[model samples]
Target chain A: MTEADHETVRSGLETHLPRLWRYGLSLSRNPSVAEELVQATCLRALERQSQFRTGTNLRAWLFTILSSIWKNQLRAEKVRTGGGFADPETELVFDGAASMETNNLLRRVLSEVSELPEAQRQAVILVYVEEFTYREAAHILEVPIGTIMSRLSAARGKLAGLDSSATNARKTRADEVGKN
Target chain B: MVSAGMADHPRDEDLVAYLDGELALADRQALDQALSDSADLRARLEVLRGGDRPFRESFDLLLDAAPLERMRAALPDPTISASVISTTQTPPIPANDWRSLGIAAMLLLAIGIGFAVGFGTRSDMGDTALLAELDALEAELEEAEAAADAAPVATVKGWRQAVADYQVLFTTDSLTPDQGGDGALALASSQVGLNLDPATRAAAGLEFRRAQVLAFNSKPLVQLAYLGDDGVPVAFCIIASNKPEAGTQYEQRNGLGIVHWIIGGYGLMVIGDLPEERLNSIARDLRKSIQL
Candidate 1:
């Protein structure tokens, strides 16, 4: 890349770092990994500056690069080693009497969303958190629009279930408090 | 697939698309009518949108999370590049002029003196040097004692420095196979007692990425990169220890969290941009899975 090109890429990377990190966190579910993904994405963007069309969307381009790296690494990992399955539905289920009167319900809901299955979590994060259009999310994730829709649907249903359970828990707690 | 209960109603995917405004004009009109006619559909739609509020809120933390200063620092300096380009574009400098040479020498001497003074006295030239050094030494000793109390171990500050250096190397082309030669699992096995097995790493919710031999503080360490389920990068580092003792320590440097422990004669470190608690949990899992 030319000297001016390097400067341009540097400015672009800085501007997008925070959003890329958020996307990374949403996709990977780990802060460290999110940081790495952002770093890698920055490096890739600089390395392949020629490939980046000037008139196109830089944010979407970066997200696509980040998603590609994550998926490639994930695929390589799956090939070398397979992990034991942890049941997300069981792990994230709320107890009937657990408190739902959290001051930061948004954070609570987000945490619950993070605990979702990886595909569903990414779908929800891109659609709801980042406010990406379905087509944009589908393009970034390298999945069909139908897949994105299905993932979002499943994610929505899961969240609704969790919310109702939490609501019921709050009610049960109130009822017991009233009885005593 | 539509659920048995929702057989007569529209599919959940259709409802989600309607909520997202992804439906076409005609489809949106039909869904709007369905929503107006059916209370059940509206209630379900509201529940589905409930997550949208909190889901968006969770992401605010990511924005508020500290900026990636280290990554930015690793980028190429445009000022230096601009200077390089300018020099190449310009004619060669004339044979060094004595006047300019003399001025450059004086500037160098002044900067050298400034650095020496800064290092030696830290701008403090009082008789309290002994007390300051003593205080610093005492603090260091106290920290050592506390670490000893928690677990019998010698401090390996090199591991932390290595992690810092690795973070720098990771962003550059030097990190690619052409430069550092990506050391395989077999190579890693020869350096230390541990294996970069996926099954072992998976116990800690990490997936192995690559392993390489990197030098830090004049010592070669086997550094294995892993991706946690959420895509956080975790480094599993091992170096030969002078003291074959088993103890664990936690430290945070340059916004990255490190959990280093000794097992057998090998010093192992788990480093990442994670919290201390999270690092400890991964370390605990590693300790269990690695079998020393």
Candidate 2:
């Protein structure tokens, strides 16, 4: 590639690769799968170089590509296999719960967030985890701002319910310890 | 009115907009007011906003784990050589130009010596006086070159010497803005056309943005060019004078003219793009008003 072309590609990769990987991991929930997804996205980006416009936001473009790749290629297989699904009881069980109660509470909250529906999970990850604006997330996901808002709202509600339950559980454990 | 005051809690959409500072001012005001009244909504927003901390931290750790070499390996090689080659080519110098000049001068000198010797054989003339004069002139040129070279390389002392040599071509008055028609200003301006040091040009108050020093003549003279802040092409012919008194001489190819002087432990120069009259005015002012 020409120097200008090389700089364009290098900068695009640097800025968007991490976001692509994170999105991939969210979709696949497995490190190896995420790595494969990111690698595929990069190779596709290189192959389709002519489609990328100079000076536009490369991160947005890459995320859009990755999202499409997941929905079109990975989604059906993932749904069929349901292989990476977390077992709630096992995932929620914390070995250090008695000694590190606060950490246990936080871990339970994060696990509950992970258990949210895929749409809500993606919205939460985009807006809160990756710190994208709602408009940016909506654009990346090919949805309207209203859709993002509803998803985030649903995600927040689910998290609040989980938070309350964890708090109640902690209170009961505290009560038992006091009684002892 | 009671029902309006008891309107349902602002939706999660509004809370997200509020967090991002994107809500309309009035909406933001309404949400802030509602947040004060509704502990449940506040708690919900706080939890949603804070819940992503571990996720972000973990993602950042994963990104850090990807080796820098892996990222570098992913990038295509830059075709820098092709770009460089297409951008420019050095013009070829005429092979015999300097050689011809040297041969011509040597032949002329030999003819003159032969005539002097043949004439001395025929008549008792003051040939010795003529020969002595030529020898004395050669010695003076050598002295000038030696004096210019004595300054250390890449030091302020070296720059100072270059400035002094350049000043010798002009009259001795300290250059300033008010002295518009001074011979020193004219000579300094003319000498800047000669190749000189780039650093001395820069330090002497000629603004050369993104300049590279192309050539250094002996120790005190250099040539440089760069685009100026004004987007004009600026070329410098500079000289550094390292005498106890130091100064710089500068001339421009396109934009500005400069001549700096250093004498009696102080340094000074004239710099601008104006006509000779205006430059002289500036030079005279610089000479009379400025200490260095």
Candidate 3:
């Protein structure tokens, strides 16, 4: 693309960075990874600016780039190491929770959702949390609406099955030990 | 947690869609009525609702996830706001930035055009120097090429001896034909349509010491030489030949670098201890001053 076109697409992409970051966080579940993912998405969007129709949804276009990059990273990671999340403690490094109790609760929730399979977790985050319509989430994820619906349904089922009290008790005991 | 009582209850997808308001109006109305009648359906719906909170809370980090400024820095300056209320109205890049882009585009276009013209095809023979000069020049180049293979670059015979002798004459300020200062030197150079101007010498980090009109193979050659700021000798020779040429060829000897190229029907060669790039720059300057 010409530099002018690049600058234009860049400004267009700047408008979508926050949502892209959130979508990145949802996909990677790690702050640093999400940051890098958003950076890559912006770069890719700028590089391929010509592909973007000027008046189309820039947010959707950026999300599409982010989703594609994150998926490729996941695929490369999978090829390199057969796919896995980092240790949960590493993820905790960026928790920035308001209090110990909230931290525990947030971590519990995070762990539960993170443990869900990728498709289900993404479906839940994009639809329920991000509040995208099923169709919009489908477009972002590049899946059919039926796939989005079922994934969301399955995610809810898994999340509902987690015992919050048991998770809290576990965190409480771990905290007590740390204190000792 | 819906007790195994209600059949034909909305499937989980349908219920999730209902919660999402993704259900069609008629389907949503039917589920709303059925929900009021069946406690089990309400409980089932409640369980689905419970999952929504954690999912929302899990991603809520995003709500507070301030954009990392470094993310925006990847773009050009004057940051574009992430809240660009509408993408269609993307701010135009400033005009000067556009002008810079235009200049860069033109530069690349010029380079491409130059490459195509320089190497793409032979300029017609008529566009070259007369045939006899072409033959003589090619023969001289061929002989120099064969001699260069057997000798170190600085010690190449024929022209090397002439350049070395000229270097000595130039270093000792003993040039004949033109032995005066700036005015006389400029007069001599202008007479031959070339300049032995000190500004050019200064640009090449040398001080002009003398200019001479000499001959090689009965062809008039203008020899201009200088002493570098460090006292090493540098020299340039402009030859008036009827030789056609392709482009410049570079030869480096011991420490001296030589560049030879033809302008119109005259050949110009610069011999120096400077880098080949420096020699080429001087050659380009001289080429710029000459017209076919």
| Distance from true location, Cα of A47 in model 3, Å | 2.6
Q: lDDT, candidate 3, residue B47?
A: 84
On residues A30-128, what C-alpha lDDT tens digit does candidate 3 reach at each position?
554565566656645643566787666677778778888677544355234322234433342243433334555666776667777778878877777
DockQ of each: 0.19, 0.05, 0.14
For residues A74-138, what per-residue lDDT tens digits would candidate 2 score against the true structure? 55654554433333233221222222434544555546655777898788778777778788889
Per-residue lDDT of candidate 2, residues B28-138 (tens digit): 777788888889878857865653335554344335433344334333222211111111111232221222122222222222222122211221244354445434534
Give per-candidate clash totals: 6, 36, 3
Q: Tell me each candidate's TM-score.
A: 0.47, 0.42, 0.47
Q: What's the lDDT of the predicted structure labeled candidate 2?
A: 0.46
The lDDT leader among the candidates is 1
Candidate 1 residues B67-168, lDDT tens each? Answer: 467445434344322211121121232221112222222221221111111111223343244334433534554464466568644454455564653442
Per-residue lDDT tens digits of candidate 1, residues A1-180? Answer: 454655566688788888887777566444444555676676457546656765567788888999997787533442232211122332221221123443465556656776777899888878887888999999999999889987887777777774545544543554565456
For model 2, what is the alpha-carbon lDDT of residue B203? 34
Poorly placed runs, candidate 1 (over 4 Å): A1-8, A74-103, A162-180, B1-9, B79-292
Output the better candidate (1/2) by TM-score.
Answer: 1
